[model samples]
Each structure stands twice: as C-alpha cells, then as structure tokens.
Target: MTALIMLVFSLASLFMFPLMAQPLSLGLAIMISTLLMCSLASMMLSSWYGYILFLIYVGGLLVMFAYVAALSPNTLFGSGSPLLFFSALLVPLSLILYLYPLKDFSLMTVLSDYSGFMYLKSYGSELISPDSMSILIGLGTILLLNLIVVVKICYYQHASLRPFNEV
Candidate 1:
C-alpha cells in the first residue's frame, strides 16, 4: 500500500515538473520524484541498492542543478490547475489500487516465484552479473551522447543559457 502511494505521488509530482514556475521548484520536484523512486526501489530490492542508487541520482541532480541554475532564468509563474488536477487524480488511483485484489493477478504469482517481491531481487542481481556489462556500457554511451548534445547546444548565444548584460 505504501509503495503504491509512493508511486502515485512520484508520478504526480513528475507530471507537475513542467508546470513549476521557478527553476528551484522544478529542481525540488525532481528531487522529490527521485527520492520517491529510491524508496520504492528500497522496498522492492534492498536498502543498500536503493541507497547507492539514490546517491548516484542525487550526485547527478546536483551537477545538473549547477548547470541549469547558471544557465536558465526564472520565467513567469505557473498556474495552480495542475496541482488540483493531480490531487483529484491521486485520490481515485489510490483508492483503486488499495481496493483491488492485487494478489490474484498472474503477474504477481510469476514475480513471487522469483525470490519474491516482483522479481526485483533477482533483477538487481542480474544487473551486477557479467551479462549486464552491456547495460552499463549502454548507460555510459547515453551519458556521452548527452554531453555531446549539451555541448552542441551551448555555443549558440541564447538568452536562456547566458545571463543578461547591461550596455
């Protein structure tokens, strides 16, 4: 029940990220979402795994925040409608999940057969296995591509990436 609630809240906050008025608010949303994900992972896998994952996520977020804070300006304030919408959505989703007979589902049965808890334990193990080296390399490649993209976007003189200058 707690995990479901966490998932819902995280997802709702994720949806609200773009609606945030300030860059700080967006960063807060991102941090909250990431923390919620970490918590969920901790429940499914292990505390150690979640803690390591969270540390990595927070480290990346801090670096990204530094870049964005130096680059992005505070734009116009956003409206409150999305908050209300998320609130409405959260209640019903929670209720449905809470009342639903989740045990009866075949998916849960299969997951239970694999070291319990939705196969997350085995999945985490597989991630550390030799067969998963490609996954790690793929993640590195993605990071490299992201750096290349950011560099490509940086050379242009944009009002967003650079602070204002007075004549």
Candidate 2:
C-alpha cells in the first residue's frame, strides 16, 4: 500500500514535469500521466477501471490535442534548464519520500489491511455494483462534455485558432 502511494506520487511528479513544456508536449505529458495513474489505479484497485480510464483518456483526448496542436502558434520552446532542475529536485524528493515509509512499517501494514475497503463496496459487489456503473458513466459523460467544450472554444473565427486561408 505504501508502495502504491509512492508510485502514485511518482507518477504525479511525472505529470508536473510537463508543465514546463509547450502545449503539444504538455498534452503528451498529460496522456503519459493519465496512463501511469491508470496503471497505478489498476494495481491498487481494479484492472478494468484503469483500462477503461486509459482508453477514454487516449481515445477522447487525442482529438482535442490534435485540434489545439493545429490551431496554436508553433512557438520555439527552449526551457531545457528548468526541466533539468525539476528532474534534480524530484529525484531527491522521491528518494526521501520512499525512505520515510520504510521507517514506519506498522502504518503501511495497517493501510494494507484496509486496501479492499471502498465506499462503493458498501453498496454492493464491485464488479456489478451501481457505484461502478455510475463511475463509468460519469467518466464518459465528462469526456463528452470536455470534447464539446474544446470544440466550442476552438472556433475558427477566433484569431488564435483561425486557419490562414491565403494562398
């Protein structure tokens, strides 16, 4: 359980690394972060949930990413120094974090004992429960809403998003 928490934090740091990047790179980072988070969730919770989330993120988000990539100005991003600095900073933080848990194994054991506990399980079986179904449906609805919002925001009339029609 401690390991899973550590893994999630590590993946979270991976997500933060992309904030220094351009939009395309940031989108890629977000996708990678989603994948890593999904994998971690799969390990901690259920494989199907993780798999479904990953698929939804990739399939639904890629179109929006492409639209932004096409519409956004191609600025020359040269933020290499910050990336290096973040790497140096994150490595020690992760190591220190990992060491902290090793010093307290009793807490880890207690957390592990409760790994199977979830509010949804209080309702019914995990696989076929209304909680799980609602979660999946909610995720899909959110993705659809996001897609619509992105499409709306990227109007062709907007100067930033408009394509050049001149020959």
Candidate 3:
C-alpha cells in the first residue's frame, strides 16, 4: 500500500515537470521524482538496484545542472500559485485512484517469505553470470555508442560547446 502511494506520488511529480518554469526548479523537481522512484524501486526490487539507479540519475543530473546553470541567464524565480495547481491535479488523481483499485505488487513480501531459496540467493551475481553476458555486452555497446555520439556532437569546431577561446 505504501509503495503504491509512493508510485502515485512519483508519477504526480513527473507530471508536474512541465509546470516548472525555471531550470533550477525543473532540476529540483526531477531530483525529487528520481528519489521517489528510487525508493519505490527499492521496495519493489533490491536495495542495491535502487542505490545504483539513484547514483546514475544523480550523476547525470549533476552534469545537466552544470550545463544549464552555465548557459542559462540568472533570473529571479517568481512564486507561482502552486497550491491551487497542485490541488487541482491532486483532486483528479485521487478520484482516479479511488475509482480504480491498485494491488500491492511489491516483491519484498514474497522474497521475505522464501528467504532460503537457492535460485534467489544472490541478486547482483546474475549480472556477471554467463547467461546474462550478452545483455551486459549489449548495454556496454549502447553506452559506448552514446559516448561517441555525444563527443562527436560536442567536438564540432563551430559549436557553442567548443573549447575556450578556440584552444
């Protein structure tokens, strides 16, 4: 039940992304939503997975925040009527949730009951196992490709992201 509520809140926070006008506020909202999602993942999956997810998200967020802060103009953030907007969104969300019941699909309860199972003994070990090698390779390949693409994009001679003073 708690996990379900957390999921709802996470979704709500994600929905609020478009409402944020300032980059700083948007980054804050993204961080909050990522935290909520990581907690939800921890409850549903393993704590290790949640921790990794949070670290990855936060690392990417840090880079994005640095770039946004450097490029965007510093503007005073005006207070908006968030209470009214939140209430408006909350009422509809609550109505939908009430109309459609959600079942607690968290795996923690099931795992706790059969704690001695051999197959489920170690969660992280499967990543390095031979059976999952191809998946790992594929993920690495994708990441490498993404890195190359980003480097290529940023290396354009006339691009805004070029070296300082044409170094």
Candidate 4:
C-alpha cells in the first residue's frame, strides 16, 4: 500500500512538473526534490535490489545536475560540434549502463546517466530534449522494476510470516 501511494505521488509530480509556469531553475529544483523523495522512499520500502536501483537513480540526477551547472549554455547547442555529438551519444550509453548496472548501480551510474543528458542540452533551450526524454523513459522502467521487486519481497515476507494462510 505504501509503495503504491508513493508511486502514484511520484508519477503525478513527474507529470505535473512541465505544466507549471515556473522558471527552468525552479523546475530543476522540483525535479531534484521529487527524485530524492522517491529514491529515499524506494530505498526504505524496498529490498536490497530495489535499494540499489534507487541509489542509481539518485546518483544519475546528481551527475546530470552538475553537468548542466558546469557547462556554458551557448556551447551546448551552438552548432555541430564534438561536444554535442559526444553528449548525444552519451544519452543512449547511459541508458544502457543504467539498465545493466555493474557491481550494483550506485551513485556513479546515476551521475553518468544524468550528466550525459545534461551535456546534451546545456544550451538555454527547452529541457525536454531527446536525451532527456530517454532518461525519463529509462527512469520509468527502473521504477517499474523496483516496484516489482518490492511486491515480490512483500509477498515472500508475508508468506513466511503466515505459512498456514494458504490452508
């Protein structure tokens, strides 16, 4: 029940983010906050696997934030340059990394994933670039996976506690 509520709230916030009239910075802040809250909640409610996934998501957000902060807005989308190409390539790569986390998805994977997206859209344009969209979709997939793990854990825990319930 708690997991369901949290999932609903996070999904609602994620969708509602774009409809507000706030500045881009404010939107970023909201995204960070929402991500943090969801990550923490998942960590608390989930098993080891779910916790690891949440950590990866949190790490990705931080990295993306840093990359966006470090780059000059002009260079991000100025022209056909190496940085743009690298950033573009990084998006899919990060997604791949996130999906197949090495040694358990930690902060590093999260940071790399997010950073790649930010680098792709460092310019002062819209935030919803192709990379960003991919990231979002990836996140949604992770969330679903985490939820499944949580459900499985809950089922096993309950089963162990009430072995005779089936009878």
User: For every model in order, what is the number of clashing pairs?
Assistant: 0, 0, 0, 5
Q: How many backbone clashes does candidate 3 have?
A: 0
Distance from true position, residue 50, model 2, in Å? 0.6
Candidate 1: global Cα-lDDT? 0.60
Model 1 has a clash total of 0
Cα-based lDDT for every prediction: 0.60, 0.54, 0.59, 0.42
Who is ahead in lDDT, 2 or 3?
3
Question: Residue 81 of candidate 3: its Cα lDDT?
Answer: 52
* lDDT per residue (tens digit) for residues 49-76 in model 2: 7798788788756776777777765656
Best by lDDT: 1
Candidate 3 residues 1-167, lDDT tens each? 67657656665765566555456776776787778777766665568877897899789878866765555545557577543565567667766766674433523455456756436436555345443343344334433433443343334563444458655
Pairs with steric clashes in candidate 4: 59-110, 59-111, 60-110, 60-111, 64-114
TM-score of 1: 0.62
User: What would the per-residue lDDT of candidate 4 be over residues 1-167, giving only the tens digit for each residue?
Assistant: 33333434444444333332222342353454356445533443224434565577667656644543333122222233423444454455555554664332243235345665455335523224332343345466545544343343334433324345453
- Residue range with the least summed lDDT across 10 consecutive positions in model 1: 101-110
With candidate 1 superimposed using the best TM-score fit, by how many Å does residue 61's alpha carbon deviate from the native?
Answer: 0.6
TM-score of 4: 0.32
